[model samples]
Target: MDTNDKHYRNPEAVLDLYERPPLATWPLLSLQHLFSMFGATVLVPLLVGLDPSIALFSSGIGTILHILITKGRIPAYMSSSFSFIVPSVALMKTAGYAGVAQGTIAVGLVYLVVATIVGIAGSGWIDRALPPIVVGPIVIVIGLSVASSAADNAMMNGKHYDLTYFGVAIFTLLVTVLFNMYLKGFWSNIAILLGIVCGYVLSVALGIVDFSKVISTPWLKLPAFEFPYISYTPKKIYWDAILSFAPIAFVTMAEHLGHIMVLDELTHRNFFKNPGLHRTLAGDGTASIFAGLVGGPPITSYGENIGVMAVNKIFSVYVIIGAAVFAALFGFVGKLSALIQTIPGPVIGGISFILFGVIASSGLRILVDNKVDFNRKRNLMIASVILVIGIGNAYLQIGSFQFTGIGVATVMGILLNLILPREALSEE
Candidate 1:
């Protein structure tokens, strides 16, 4: 009677630091993570005029490097960092794709420098710098900042709302929400995956999917890898490219800190100390370098994948590695990649609707769970600034490189936390 079916496993079971699901279920579990990250990962490169296939290939390798560098503890999935999009796009006009790639490598070097320091000095300062008051709002900002992107996918049709697509999105969101809340055993963990499948099927029924993409793409093809120059040449000093990317590393590092804080709050573990911030930073840096070498956007920790982990309560690094393998392999399989791309925008939107909201709610949970006193004037100010700047999508630019949205909010939150006065770790 197949009593050993993975479906029979407890729905509420958590796969934590060292835990894993049954071997048979690993691929399904891993595919959900891939689905969770796929849209945004590909979208970044598309928006910036890089090949999506290369982005997939590089992100796959980068995530693997991340898992290895982190000592296989944190289940973070690295993807194209949204942080560098603006500057990279701008640099592309003057310096071309080569310049963007160089800037990305510089960003990697910046991460390495920070990683070395964090490794030597310890992460106690990170704890002090990103207290819940500061971190909670920033994380909220991080999650909510992308709300429009999700909403656009789920509901918008061109410039106007499309009733048909909206219905599909709503249906997808409903299915995912119901499974998350009511489903039992192993099924509950894959609500997002199930939701995406359901939505895709409905989209197919409605004739929204174009079969041409799958038909036109070849069965197998190699992604174009753009290699970077390792040395300063006679023709170019390359300082401009370096300048374009290096400063933002500090900004995105702060974003990474907010991401770690969310992870800690979600898993109830101090990732900042255990695997250590140094390792995470190093992992992210290596990812960026690898991605840049392959002519992809600088890879950074993705909140979408974090939201998936938070919902599923599955933090197994093996699942992460499995997803990485799929990503890496998908890059070589043109038809398969095209098939995945054929997934309707509404389907992605519907899933993101709940996924992004889950992340935003996590930040609020940190505040409530930690009992961060909003009554305190300083805490109020910190949270307020972060929320407004982040949610408002504000950017502060200095020279060619500037902190955008999440970066600005993160830096502001940290500065406020550092400068603000407090009697003790807890208020009176």
Candidate 2:
């Protein structure tokens, strides 16, 4: 297949690679993407009882570092991973904040070790271990895994289904699809943004959009940055924290590969061979190290931003960079950051409906483009198990850390691929 031929199945990027949107619409376009990634990044820190500002700061810095490490060749964003929440919370109680810092650092160290091995041994084994049959369903799971969250936000308000909120979500989704399908020229490229604007307006009219929290927030403040040395006892080792957190790294690495593979299918460039897996892993590891030092959650390449890339069909590294800069700036402006959080859940859900669907479709496209024949039971079995396990959310809890469905599914699929004996073609 020609380069990026699979992209034809979806919309071809209007502003691909380094290209930028018009000067007038640049910030708006970037803001649209920032909205895409902001919810989960901030939510992870909040869930783990850490200050969200530090997360925004670290994610921005880490993302820029990732871009630099990859030589600006990949359009990806780094954000807080949900994987570490359980262990992070548990360790915080036993080991305290300082110990959690050490645990987070341990997680980063794991990434570095894996990256070093990849650098020395090369990334060829990645393809051998994870072929398309195994990868496609993982990609599908990545998009559909959080589907229930989207549905909950769409119709439910505080655990109860609210018809008003349901209407808002549906309306937002409708507007987004209409704009995407009907708009001409540059306007069509930002259909998600336009939809969100319309949805937010409707929410405000219905009195669901809250501004009280934004009003109380300060105009400027420094993020509460933490250092391990400030709290760690001299010459002390935190093995409990390390053991709880380090093993989870393998699962996230699996996710890292899945996300990169999704991009490879979306951009039609073999990232595994180009910038190579080692550089991405090295960049990811370094970012996580920075995050842990500053008392922020570990960073992972974000799938939400990938969803936005697929929906907008604008895979520009500049756009990703712009969003990162904006995220970092918001980390300092308490008022602005608080205000962004006020964007109602329905609006987020509305946009996510389209974004996530686009991601799942891209996964399907990979199967189609690669001609994955389901006629073969082995091919069929691997894809089926991955899909069911991932979408069903059948997770494995390792100590405090719960290995997510997609992560578990990825690992299981690879093992199945490697372990299962294959029959010759004549047998079929």
Candidate 3:
């Protein structure tokens, strides 16, 4: 057999075979990716006390906007980011539900500003000022710091049980790690799905999952129309959420750069050089802007789905477009979101363990790609400051505004990067 026959040489062909599949194949692939990301999409709404259907609907529409902004060149799926989940929880606790609503609306506007910044300065300028020194460690911090809570929850089975959920979580995590590392072909791509299946089985056997909610949920119903702006109280715009999340758009913009790079590698085309980073950045911004407007959470291009496209070698943007259409349709169906919510926690967590890790690793890859010299004093300083401030919840107060978490870290990194001069002794 020819080498090309044994392994698909064309990215489009591989995508056709495995990743860039048409509408007919979307149900399975979309469902699989959906499960991996569903917890994140729902968690924000549940915690912030917003309607989950709106989140789902916005996510669907956001993906469409992203595709349109990029002129349907990039094949990536936009979804919820877990980074916002705990923040949403904190916003609710500190400022009440109304405060969270106002804060989220304000946060959406931040995305618009970031999009505008990219539009004005152009994409090349973004790389010069921010670079990997600022972006890499911050992403590592984003993953590890945000993960502490999940790890803690996994260890404690509420107040009553001990070590049971911990064991299950560990088992789930191990399966994800092993499968992603060792498994190949379709198995690798579906590792999260399989791991979730195993975790669900165990949860059922242990009687940990309550199926009553699933049973009681209606099979079909119109999505509850959530007027997110309805809850927007001007007095309740918590400065903490506004300051803390707004600057995060910077790091998120860096994250978009990584996604574009991966797509370029998968497609064997420097997408940035053509339809370009500027176009993709505009796409991301538009997605975020439109998503926010529709009472949806902020949308980011999913690296996991890009990996799916890379592995499958399906390069047709239409496939992703079709996926977007499906997501949009499903968003209007309350039963769809409800059905996903019915999945056992451990199962969802099992999938999250894999996907989230992949997200963090993608950030590290950015640092590596830039060949950041960690040994240098300037580079080390930038990396250290960003990671600490980002993960340690470093905060600053100026008059009525409060800056903390990723927001604080992003601003700090950008300043340090610009101020710190390159070494006199330059080496190639």
Which candidate gets the maximum lDDT versus the true structure? Answer: 2
Residue-wise C-alpha lDDT for candidate 2, range 21-50, written one tens digit per residue: 778878877888888888888999888888
Report the C-alpha lDDT of model 3 over 15-55, residue by residue, as the tens digit. Answer: 53223554455556555555655666777677666667777
Question: Candidates sorted by TM-score, descending order?
Answer: 2, 1, 3
Model 2 score (lDDT): 0.85
Listed in order, each prediction's TM-score against the native is 0.92, 0.94, 0.74
| Candidate ordering by lDDT (highest first) | 2, 1, 3
Worst 10 residues of 1 by lDDT: 1-10
List runs of model 1 lying over 4 Å from the truth.
Answer: 1-13, 228-237, 423-428
Question: What RMSD, rounded to one decimal, does every model reach?
Answer: 5.1, 2.8, 5.9
Expressed as tens digits, the lDDT of each residue in 1-428 for candidate 1 is: 22222233224338865677798889999999998899888889988988899999998999999889888867788988887888888877887777887889888989999899989999898777877887788879978999999888988777888888889999999999999999987899888999999999999999888989899899998887776554222245457878878888888887788788888777667778878999999999999988877789988888888888888888777889999999999999999988998888899888888878888999999899889987888888899999999999898877766777888888788898888787545665
User: What's the residue-level lDDT of 132 in candidate 3?
Assistant: 69
Clashing pairs in 2: none
Query: What's the lDDT for residue 160 in model 3?
Result: 48
Q: Distance (Å) between predicted and true CA of 309, model 2?
A: 0.6
